[model samples]
Target chain A: MRRLAPAVGPLLLGLALAAACHPAVAGLLGDGGANRPLSLTRLSDLALNHLTLAASGFAFVACLGLGLGLVVTRSRFAALRGGIDTLAAFAQAVPPVVVVALALPILGFGGPPTLLALAAYGIMPALRGTVGALESVSPEAREAARAVGLTPGQVLRQVELPLAASGLIETLRTAFVLAVAVTAVGALAGASTLGTPIVAGLQNQNVVAMFQGTAAAAALAFLGDALLLAAGGLARREAA
Target chain B: MRRRIILGLAGAAVVPTLLVLLPLMHFAPNRLLTGTAIDAPSILGAMLWPLGALAAIGPGLLAGSRGRLAAAIAALACLGAFALLLAGLGHGAAAWTAGQPPAARARLAAGAWIGASLLAAAVPLGARRVDPAAGGPIGALALAASVQGLWLAGRLDALSVVVEFRARRDELAAALLDHLALALGALALAALVTGALALWRRGRGLVDLTVSGLQVVPAVALLGGLVTAASALLSAAPALRTYGLSALGTVPALVGIAAYLLLPLWRGLQGALRAPDAASLDAARALGLTPRQILTGLRLPLGASVLLGGVRVAAVQALGLATLGALVGAGGLGTLVFDGMAQFAPDLILLGALPVIALSLAAERALSGLEAAARRHWPS
Candidate 1:
């Protein structure tokens, strides 16, 4: 109960804020549009789809980024570090929308292209985080673990990863937040995320649907951030 | 004597060589339909020598202090090859459409784009891996010279993007200017706001809350919120419209971009202001320097690089977010991108996107160089 206490604040704050905003339906807002009024069932369905896309994108990025970060940091592979940095810098320079647009031709309109773009855009943050977190592990800890006659793999698992857990969690938080935000841009590529209505509104000049979509997207992003914060809090407490 | 190969050079060259095996161009009968892939070998027949040369030199570059000159030469060779490859791609694009009507299109496919971007980016990395000091300036000069050469000869004119650009030349120029104005204008505003907040000192909590709160909002949503608020205000006070304040254009776009920029700018400002060592600050105090003198004479000088570091981040981010401005009719390069998307013309989209990517990368490189120069002067 003590460990879980810190998680409750953000979780409750997120929920309370979300609930407060829930009543500002399209009809109440009164900006005229032909689009359907945003109902609770429809809203939740959109939210779930958004979450699914973001989660899958995050998962793919985490695996590839973590693996690449690990491999490049190894002694024998140190020569590849400069190349990885250059590639990562290039990746960062290209905007997420551009990635989505470019992927549209190859992957066609829908979830797959959005997913690919999200994965591409998210890779840089995850890779940078893993590399930075692992590097932050004190050299002394590794040396001490080695002195205890532990194998290289054992030292990494028992010493380095344990020490780097907090930073890694922080990295995941950043990556997840990014995934959530970029997924909204996925609507441009025909993925039925929250940005769907915003794009639709823009096309039809439907101010109300755009406003509602914007509010819902913002709420969804905040909710994800809060959920991640709670999860980070729980992890820290467990580590302690 | 034992010879060790430079792995960076080897990897950089080999990857592009492998990518060449994939489709290098896409040929479509018209702008709106699916295209067929064209292989590199079919287009670049004799011109593939540059690529072959790069592959041959890849593993041959030596690793060691003695290999510095070799690395520099190799770097120049790699870039020169890259320039030639680009020219080949353009010419190939032209030839592939020679027999077809003007409505037919030939654009660089995924493989060529991926390979070209990778090679262009990797050459510097490979150079630095071997000889960090000798390669940067000379390589940059060579790249500039080659690009100028291509432009002078009009070799890249036949490429689909250049064709698109010729059609919308004036619009493209105006969009580029708008992009710069939006990004830089917002950057300046964020700096001022951050500077004011930093001076307030008591607003630390306010700054933290604002920064984190702003981050939670998706950028498009933020823009939408601003648009709604502005329009509502305009409706309530019709007189404000006389002052040229309206929703749906530069006003909301600037505010939204600046709103997102506050976090990075504020963090940078705080970090730079606090950069002076405690002992240095104490010494300045003991020497009877005023707070203003200490800040100007000590802190500002030392923290210049750190502040510039923050500006680089904010600038890159601003350039990217500016793309969303097109959604609100704030016309920029994204106009071309969204227009192309609506028409399903990949080449047209690339025409907008490629420039944006180039601008951000150029900004990052220039700012980083400034940061390094600042560090050298400050010695921190």
Candidate 2:
């Protein structure tokens, strides 16, 4: 934690400072001719939508990923892990926007397609993190817990989960950040997001709008990164 | 063993359940409108029996198989069953579209794609129960052979995706070339930049920081920022526009992609360079080998696999990210994807997406093979 502080401190500070200055940046860039600049309230609203979509999708992916990871790590389900790991790797190689575009046909446009894409794209990181974190828990510890006559469920809840907490938190953080990124791409699918301005501005050649949108989107990602980093820091400290 | 059997049985149940629950195909009068659905088991009369037989026998073999060879054979049977079901769908589509206009499309719908994908997934998942490595090779071979046979028999000619391909053959070729160029160009740029930086020991910290900072920004935001910056530059010196230094299109896309690729490439190179341990380096030094000779003779050979591993990741990511080039008017396959989104043409979107997926997978597999070969030869 101490070593991480030097790196984390400046990153957090820089992101926050950049994010804090967005309104001023927007003002400086000015509005493109005949196009209304996104007001602070509108930008906040879009950011909220972006976060909401990311959080909702992250929630679904977290549950699915954690469940799958737990199942595959069990002794009986070991054989299934290799196949799933391969599939997850393959899925991760596809770009998030392409996933959104592919889902658009099946789910139609708007929030549903965006949500589906977010879940699909985010699953790989979450699952890999969970499996890795769980696997990192020493076998000796699990054996000790079992030797104490703790049931499999009890061992998992009391022994494994506690040991895995920091790793799990880190996984969630990575997965959440990924969800945030995918939400920005979800703008192409007509989901109202920080990416909305970016896409609209691109079509209209509104440079100011584009800049503002890009800034806000970056701000959202940075904010998410900071919050998650703090949470991960707390987890690491608790574990220590 | 009981769990494996249960899993096999559950896998076998997926296709039949999906077939009943969802429509097998969607038929549109033209490309513009949402189509009516054709359900399998209801419309495909005699084809269902063979599919049913294969499904049952595939799972039975999985349950009965105690050896890796048997499990592999079971995987092959399951994949062949999936192929036969798809061929049946193609035949059904042909029958449905017999009297329709040229614009009419009869394509496999959500059910077929979802069901077939699940079934395909099941083959490996089931086969791997006996042996972890038993499934993939057999499944791929079976899939390729059946797809080829179906294509040669003209069984898949009526599929809307095939029809879409036929209609846009020339445009598809151009898009393919553009897509390849964008991805490969960005990869080459990243390789050169990272290679130079990796050798500059004094600038390592700053380079790492810059790469991480670039990664922190989302790809879209990075691309947008590049567009803004490039436009600013071009406007400041309009003379540069004549030299093809435009704000939008290929320039921003290429730069953004290369920026993202830097971190992976740099990390991989660092890992590879460090592959020779302290003892090995000390021994090489004691042997009176110069630093440059040590690098080429020991580090390069030993670290080849690690380097290739990194390149594999960056290359695959580049291919995927290049699709966004279309968004900036660079005119890659993503143009088809976005155009499909705007026009609500699913086949057009598939035409773009499937190729990108294939390209990424192919790069991944090819690089992995090379990495394995490196590890074999060097044993590091």
Candidate 3:
């Protein structure tokens, strides 16, 4: 790694500097053509839409997933696991196009259906994470709790839930990132987000707007993930 | 317990097939002089074979574990009987429309389509995954041959999907092939990258994170990114345009689809190898196995199912994403969808969506079957 970096590092730096200094960089980074390039106002508007949409959708996913996960991990719900796994996997496999298209007719094309689709899409990974992490908790841990004076409910609440919390947070990070990115599809269904320019550009064959939209959306996702990682680190540090 | 599950599944299949077919006009006239759909006298007979198939399962259930042959036969009989009934319905339609005008042909109503799909789904659900009833090559071949034979006999020609297919036979055929090609091209590209990344000993985390991050990018933005990058590349290399590789169409579509595959494929490989655990790997090292020997001898072969699981996901995803390739003029089943959306024709949308769904399901089932077979016979 050390030897290769000496030869490659400066080359990459020079390329980045060269590209940043290119003639098209400004227009490429801007929202669209010179007539209506992205202003500070529009960028903030899109970033707000992107973040809020993801957060709202993520909230629904967290609740639905956590509730369902806790329910199905119960001993009585053992038989339900296979069906839930299949259903969630199926939900995930379904292309967002179908979801948006189908939802448009019933939900009548707006943020609701987009939110519906994102929440639906986001719930599966969270569910799988919660269930998997909970199940991976050893039987000995459960027995030790039982050997203590704790009731079954108390044991699950204090021990299993805390143990599973780390993995669930990671899953939510994934779900949030996914919701933010997938909201781009919602733009096609008439919901305004960072994807507005991307889908519109695709539809109208405008490459400049597309580049800008793509960059903005990617940046939003990057920032969302970074925020999640920082939050996770802070939580871990506080616990430590 | 096995018998009870098998019987329960069989009973479940019977209900839908019966409910959808019975008491309805197999082909009701659109000219319902009244409010309700009034059926012709002969339409009531469509329930006979389905009932017969249901009855066959009764006897099969009693035969127990020894009745593997009986269960297989019952499942086949149900599906075959359902297919024959559908064919017979087609024959009736052809006869009914024999003297009609050239433009006048009877189409299976939506009910018939629903019924047929239920029967198709039921056939698979009826088959238990036990020995002999696991649906072997012979059963698959028979099913394929029968489906083809029905097509040859024009038995399936009366369906609305067939009508739409006939209207654009050449285009639909080309689109189907194009869809397959696009999927394969994307998979090949992804597999190449995944294979390289798997072999690399360093920066695995960085690669995994980047790939996963790429996955979270929306399909639209990714496509846009691809287009932007392609345009930039095309502008930089004017000579490449002379070779028939344009900025749009297959090139960008393949790259876009490939971007989605890298994450799953890489994760699958990493997970599969990691399954052996560090302790086993260390033991292998102690035994003096070279790294190449370890990877080829242990990881790749033992982890075959894990790898295929990723490929299966990739393949199924590619099948659906290939539909989006049509938006860029790559011409796949997605053309049917976008065109249908453009024209606001629901049937045209179904025309596209149904086949894509079928292809995705088929790819998934086939991959799963391959994984099961590999796991059964794979080297330890």
Top of the candidates by lDDT: 2
Q: Model 2, chain B: what is the TM-score? A: 0.91
Q: Per-residue lDDT tens digits of candidate 2, residues A1-240?
A: 562463375466547644653665565665547345677888889888988998899899999999999999899777667667878877777777788888887787789988877877777878989999999999999999999999999999888888998789778877876787788888999999988888887777666666667666666666666666777677667656
DockQ values, each candidate: 0.57, 0.61, 0.30
Cα lDDT, model 3, residue B210? 84
Model 1 off-target regions past 4 Å? Answer: A21-27, A31-36, A203-208, B1-13, B16-20, B59-66, B129-134
Model 1 TM-score relative to the real fold: 0.92
Query: For residues B1-380, could you state the per-residue lDDT of candidate 2 as single tens digits?
Result: 67667766775665677777899899999886669988887556687877876766675666545566766666766786788788888888888889889899997788888767766765765665555444455555667787888898898998999999999999889999999999999999999999888879898899988887676566776787788789878889999988978988898999989999998898889989999999999999999999999999999999999999999989998999999888777888998888888898889988999899889878987797789889999997
Worst 10 residues of 1 chain A by lDDT: A17-26
Q: Model 1: per-residue lDDT, tens digit, A104-170? A: 8788898998888788778888888999999999999889999999998898788877788878877
- What lDDT does candidate 3 reach at residue B278? 78
In order, the interface RMSDs are: 1.7, 1.8, 3.3
RMSD of each: 2.8, 2.8, 7.5
Model 2 residue runs over 4 Å out of place are: A1-22, A30-36, A140-159, B63-66, B121-138
- Using DockQ as the measure, name the better of candidate 2 and candidate 3: 2
True contacts kept of 3: 0.46
State the lDDT at A144 in candidate 2: 99
